[model samples]
Target: MKKFNSTIYMSGKYLFVGMLLLALLGSCGNNADKTNDTGKQKREQLPAQAGKEKAKTIVFFGNSLTAGYGVDPSEAFPALVQEKIDSLHLPYKVVNAGLSGETTAGGKSRIDWILRQPVDIFVLELGGNDGLRGIPIAETSRNLQAIISRVREKNPQVKIVLAGMQVPPNMGRTYASAFRVVFQQLAANNQIDLIPFLLENVGGISHLNQADGIHPNPQGHKIVAENVWRVIQGLL
Candidate 1:
């Protein structure tokens, strides 16, 4: 009888030990599953965060000159910028938002829609129409200010490169000075990059300009590209 009791006690103790080991193993398995699930979630979220570390985007916003006025779209300044980015293998996208005959007011009106995308840089070129139509310089300046403010509201850190325009001397010295000052003052106050004139090399030269004497020819577009590239490269 004593031997049988001892045998039963031993059997009970072994069974309890086995059950405890099984429970510990099950707990470890559950912890491993949880760790794997966490890692998968982190992997899934990685792609979305990847682009932020790649490169920035550039957006060209302006009027007829920006629309490749007299030049082919591929030979335009914006295209040249795209080419530069490609040749350098820079992970960037240059977007053209040019519209022929757009004034500062028109640009202001359309800016909200244009800014719907992720724009890392804005190359602003407007107010030529205001100069042509003899609009008040103050009004043109105000419109441009509003556009800048709107962009700032969307992104406080957005970099702006303003492509300034010079009116014909035929418009009178006072008007021309006012028009130029609109860009100068804004650039100074906002601490943004400024291209003194979009048509620096093509302006007033019949050979470089198209039949309209307003738009630039292909060779002229190359010069414009150089002008823009100078400022953009420095900032970047």
Candidate 2:
């Protein structure tokens, strides 16, 4: 009887030891699985963050002129700007957000959303549509002022290049003079880079203009790109 009792006790001891070992192995396996999952999540997130950090963004905000209205996308001045930047091996992306017929107020309203994206530079071109529509020049100027102010407030380090526009001479001398002065005065007061008359040497030239006599053709876009490059290259 004593022998049987001792044998029973030994059996119970071995069972306990075996169960403990199994439990320990199971726990270790679970911990390893958890570690692998965590590592995978971190690896997945790294690429997205790296892509965001690596991308350099530039926004072109303006009216039809910036849109290259009636022109091919590849031949547009913004695309040309991209080409030039690529040729120089600059690490940046240019986003053309120009809406045909957009006035200063239109630009001001949409600027908040536009700025939400990563923008290193803003090629601001507006007021041309306002001038064409015969809107009050003061109102146009005020809207432009607000746009610039808001952009600066949101991104203190962002570079700004303002593109100037001219009212057609047929739009009365008073209106034309006021329209031309708006860009010049704003640029002078704010100490901003200004491209005097975005359509310089191309406007009214039937060869450069499209059928509408307003927007530039492909060849004209090349000239426009040159004008913008002169101002923007220095900024970069």
> In model 1, which runs have C-alpha deviations exceeding 4 angstroms?
1-55
- Top lDDT prediction, candidate number: 2
Determine which window of 10 residues in candidate 1 has minimal summed lDDT: 48-57
The local lDDT score (0 to 100) that residue 138 gets in candidate 1 is 92
Stretches of candidate 2 exceeding 4 Å from the true structure: 1-53
Question: Every model's Cα RMSD, please?
Answer: 4.6, 6.6
| Model 1 vs. true fold: TM | 0.77
Candidate 2, 35-88: lDDT as tens digits: 999999999999888766465788999988888788788889999999999898
In candidate 2, what residue range of length 10 has the lowest lDDT sum?
Answer: 47-56
Candidate 2 residue 20 Cα shift, in angstroms, is 45
After superposition on all CA atoms, how large is the RMSD of candidate 1?
4.6
lDDT of 2 at 128: 86
Whole-model alpha-carbon lDDT for candidate 1: 0.89
Cα displacement (Å) at residue 202, model 1: 1.1
Q: Candidate 2, TM-score vs. the true structure?
A: 0.77
